[model samples]
Target: MSNPSSKPIGLEIDLLETQGGKVPLEYFHKLISQLQKNHSLDHLSASPASAGEFDVVYIILSKGTLYEETETNAYECIIIDGWSCWPAGFAYLLVPPNRRREKANISGGDNGPSDTADIKIALLPIAQTRGFGRFVIRTLLSHAFDALGIRRVTASILCPIQPSHSVAQKKQVGFNTKQLCWIFEKFGFKFEGISRGALMSMSVVEGEEPVWHDVHRMSMLITDYFQEKRSLSLSAMRSFSREFPLKVVQQSPWEIMIQRQEKEKHDVESWSKRPNDASANDACGNDGEASDDETVLGGDEISEK
Candidate 1:
């Protein structure tokens, strides 16, 4: 990321971000299209691209970093991280009109914010299981919570997003859509109501072609997401402490000398508070009075003199 003034290379020059917690719908579309062009490594056999369906996407390199292919350089940070394919994905929040507070002007059109938005991820084969998708989703949630001040973000895993080779032909093994759902659930997204056969095929399906599959909607509140993250961090710290006990510090020579001096000063103060007679009694056990033993010793000393 560059200074907020400097424009990111891949992003459009005029893409507008909203005051409330979301990318404006139009600007969001522009970014999604840009990702589709630059990072979407969809195979030919994959189901036809559906940009309208998914609002967020992501692409992470299996190794090494990639630079943005650009004509000029207003942005200095051109390197896309190998670990997180962040610039690829998109997230949306949809809210009722009553809940909206964001306002922005884009393409000479002004718009207010909404409560809910959809997020999607488009992964290259190398980016899929390395937990890159999880990273993208988590980043989007952070943006929604901190930047957009959103109530919740939604995720829908439609069957159409799956490539045909993995699902039908089984040429490659792929994670089930519900399994993907669990990843977000682990991040505190709730398993919302499901829409069975909600995804109707826009094209005519002949013979054994499957048209519709269940779509799962997962959602997370801003507060709950942050709270869950804090809890997990605390839990991890506790577990680590249990596994590796903390060692007491070894004091330096100066610190040891200072501690000994303080102890001696305390002892002096305690001794000064005691009465002289009490101290003598404690030391000689005569209560500051001469007893028969003392008299005998004095008489013996006189006779010797």
Candidate 2:
């Protein structure tokens, strides 16, 4: 079976209420079936639509109150669809900024941005990997950084085990294993230090990552070395004349033969003048003759003493 989460597709985020007052029970049943096929939903308490039936019942769930203390709160729900391998699912959750802070450890410190807003995302188990999580994060960042002019925002991943750390790493989001510190370093979150299990951020702002100038400089040096080596090799092979007037005249055939005859005559004279001793005999034993197999200089006939 194809993993629906692996499919590459854009997510469409819309308010849950836009569909109608209550979605048909059949839609919920289809969604539950899809989730059952793709993921483990044993923790959820979904009931059959009717007695002795397997179909799921449709229900409208309230998220959070719009107002604080008096039960007025803004309710946010997500309806995700268009996944090729799985049916659609709905996730409804309350996103009361103040109320959420009271119950959860939302970052609202002096180091944290004062104007930033808190947004919570709830997803059905099957819809977690179908680009829904990324879409929600991008949306939150756009609103915090672009719309509200907020420098940074924070989020709390509610799952007992957050498996999307790799996904966050791909997006360059910074992680702090400390409490209330899921800081997106791309938007100015910084490593202040370690706290509990999360990282503390002293400041948050959008900035470029540090560039490695030394790496580029080293690459240029290597390139220059190769270029210089090539130039030296080429110059060694190229023909060039010296500027000085020193000349080497070629010896004529007669001049070369005369020099050879003089050398042989001197050798014979030295051998004859030697004392009749064993050492002298040994020295002249080989004779002043070039072997027949020896190479003669510029002549076809051997010289006769």
Candidate 3:
């Protein structure tokens, strides 16, 4: 089987340039129109293809440091095509080294400060359902960790106030419940303090809220019960046997050598008690001659009678 990393997945990333020329508004408008028709950007209060809706754009267009690794730094924009179709794809922006400290403290410690080039991912609404969201995420992570020398990257998924949070938890994305109380908190994105039951509110269409509490409780209960069962099974197995499993099954090397030495000693003693081979052979020859002589004499006596 081929390694998954070696496969030619063919994703192209480009840096957006802010100087010398402007992207025609019509291009963005068309892109946004397509996004609105197919996706749920309204929940996040974001318009398709607009810089205003994306955090990555602010870092790229204003900062002028983001660039595609595969392409020359000279090229300002990249056009991605010729792959599986998805509603939403990600745009990556590289954060310069000088600015990373100012941006966010991702993990604690100054242990080997990360290079200034950081990546920020912006999700397009059109790329959401066709598994593009996950694909982009994986691809970006691969690039960041493998190619770009980046230690960290951040992205947000907008979650509905209730049951949708469960999906986020299932996906293992960070969630901040306190951020959920704030009206302006970015959907699926939190500054910090995210945990399994923390809710982050994003706009939701009116309907029956999802029953996440049941799922959460069930997840915990199942985990606890399985752990208890595993512990009991292990204890029972251990108590059922008096000897260590290894000791009961096989002799140690030292014990095997000692047994062999004792067997050799017994054989030597038994051989010493037995008569010598030469003496036994001589006694057999003498006995055979005596028997022959007795047979001949008996035959002569019978004939004389």
Better of 2 and 3 by lDDT: 3
Clashes of each: 16, 16, 10
- Tens digits of lDDT, candidate 2, 56-91: 122322222222254342123324342222223443
How many backbone collisions does model 3 have?
10
Single out the weakest 10-residue window by summed lDDT for candidate 2: 211-220
- lDDT tens per residue, model 3, 1-305: 22222322433333224412233344334434544554433223223343321123321111122333564542233233333222133344444443344345555555444443333333443222333333443454455445544544443334334444476564443233222223112111224322343333433456855332110110112233335446656766676564446454788999999999999999999988967467755655664355555676784465642
RMSD of 1: 14.0
Q: Name the regions of candidate 2 deviating beyond 4 angstroms.
A: 1-10, 16-113, 158-305
TM-score ranking of the models: 1, 3, 2
Error of 1 at 28 (Å): 13
Ranking by lDDT: 1, 3, 2
List the candidate 1 regions with Cα displacement exceeding 4 Å.
Answer: 1-114, 161-175, 202-210, 248-305
For each candidate in the order shown, give its overall lDDT on alpha carbons.
0.51, 0.37, 0.38
* lDDT over C-alpha atoms for residue 30 of model 2: 55
Off by over 4 Å in 3: 1-3, 6-26, 42-88, 94-131, 142-149, 160-305
Alpha carbon deviation, residue 153, candidate 1 (Å):
0.9
Query: Residue 216: error of model 2 in Å?
Result: 38
Could you give candidate 1's per-residue lDDT for residues 245-294 as a string of tens digits?
Answer: 99999999999999999999999999889564556556657666776677
